[model samples]
Target: MTYHRTRIRRRRAAALLAVLGAVAALIGHRSPPPIPSPTTLARQLTVAAGDHFHREPGSGALGTAGGALPDDASVFDDNYPGITRLDPDLLSALRRAATDAGAIRFVVNSGWRSPAYEDELRRQAVAKYGSEQEAARWVATGTTSAHVSGDAVDVGPTAADSWLAQHGAAYGLCQIYANEPWHYELRDGAATQGCPQMYADPTHDPRMQK
Candidate 1:
């Protein structure tokens, strides 16, 4: 009788081992989440930048009337002739971050600007602030402005800026100036290790010294 009981116990232990092994094998074969490749990101960027506006579901085509945007335009504001004026990579990054935050739109306060426009902005800053040095802290010259190169964007609606500040680095986008939470630029490897320390302001950036 004791021998029969031992045999039954061994069979039960063997069955348990088999079940555990199968479970482990199943887990090992499970696929990981897909990471976006650079090529894929580039393609997404192109598509996003090419579109002029994002309309709500059921909304009809939009047209500018009396120099005013439709009430439901995707972006809060834009100075460019078209959204494509912004850097594709930057737009791609912003889109990814916005999606993660459940934001409906990026709300661009500014995007690519012509050299003449940048220069004019600088001049206005100097006039209002009372010195070229003070203006330099707030606005870059035409030659040095990232906006003129289509590499930077100024996002608005304080909530969007706050979201970017906390999460932009995960998409290779980073706030460049400590004083300007709305400003962001693409920085290589920002997605993994994260962005570098921000300058206190543009004046503190070495790139602005020139």
Candidate 2:
């Protein structure tokens, strides 16, 4: 009887070892997490206040007539016109979107604005809207303006804005204000997680409260 009991115990131990080995093999063969899509990877690119700004090479003259912009021209991307300086990351994302969409041209209605220019825009807004509080809804103050920070761009015409509205998030660009289809900013994780809910306007943006 003792011999019989030892044989049974050995058989049980061998079965247990086999089960453990099977489990280890199963784990080793498990698939890796899915790779992010190309659009998703593009969206992960960084946009920071300190990011460098770039202009098209040899852009020399500044006015609407259009040529290579002079180094002193207030804006970059003169090739398309009306664009001021743009954050490097933002520009890259915009170009990528344009390429993906097969857009012939992407016009920048507004980009990096100096504090003074923002202030002037604010003044115009106040004049048109009748109150600073009301103007704040559409135009941010110089200090709070995303344009001043080089993190925002106002793209146009209607077709471009429409394309961006639908596809910008894939490139990490999001329309920040519900009212401004032309405006977009870089939002973290927008590629994978998607963009945050938009405020109605600058006035409604919590960042503008400061």
Candidate 3:
């Protein structure tokens, strides 16, 4: 009777071991997740890089001064002080122009600068050019800067600039300086009379004389 009981227990143990071994074999044969192709991996990396580089509206990258912008930014995103602080007329014109732009998108690089931001840029420009005189061609004094007055916008991407050059006069947005093709300002009556001739650079503008 003891030997029979022992034999029964051994059989049960063997059955349990066989079931566990079968489960292990099934798990080992299961398929793994597919690896992404090189192209897919590269595209994912590019998107991640773009997200890392870009700041959302009102992210406070430069404290409250807030002039930096991303490529996909809209003129209507007023969460940014740079967009809200723009001259009303200029902002209105930009909105209208944006609506009619079709495929072309305006990417604001800089707008509505604080005095501190303007001064810092001026200092950097002076250092880059090795003289205040040469720097004046690029950066303006805070007191006389159109950016400080909320009257100017710097837009970018070569395609956007070209599109603006062609259609901007109708919206009163004219490139202010030949040297700075990205810079634009609203010119009153530009729609009817056409835009005024662009200055060679900011140095040629009478406004900078002050």
- Predicted model with the maximum TM-score: 3
Alpha-carbon RMSD to native, per candidate: 17.5, 18.6, 15.2
In model 1, the worst 10-residue window by lDDT is: 59-68
Q: Worst 10-residue stretch by lDDT in candidate 3?
A: 41-50
Highest lDDT model number: 3
TM-score of 1: 0.62
What lDDT tens digits, residue by residue, belong to model 1 across residues 17-101? Answer: 9999999999889698897653343223323322322222332222121111232234423533323566788777776777777
Quote the positional error of residue 100 for candidate 1 in Å: 2.6
The lDDT of model 3 is 0.75
Give model 3's TM-score versus the native structure.
0.69
Between prediction 2 and prediction 3, which has the larger TM-score?
Answer: 3
Alpha-carbon runs more than 4 Å astray in model 1: 1-79
- TM-score versus the correct structure, for each prediction: 0.62, 0.62, 0.69
lDDT of 3 by residue, 4-72 (tens): 999999999999999999999998896889986533432233233224434444445343344544445
Where in model 2 is the C-alpha error above 4 Å? 1-84
lDDT of model 3 at residue 169? 95
Clashes of 2: 7
Model 1 residue 109 CA deviation in Å:
0.3
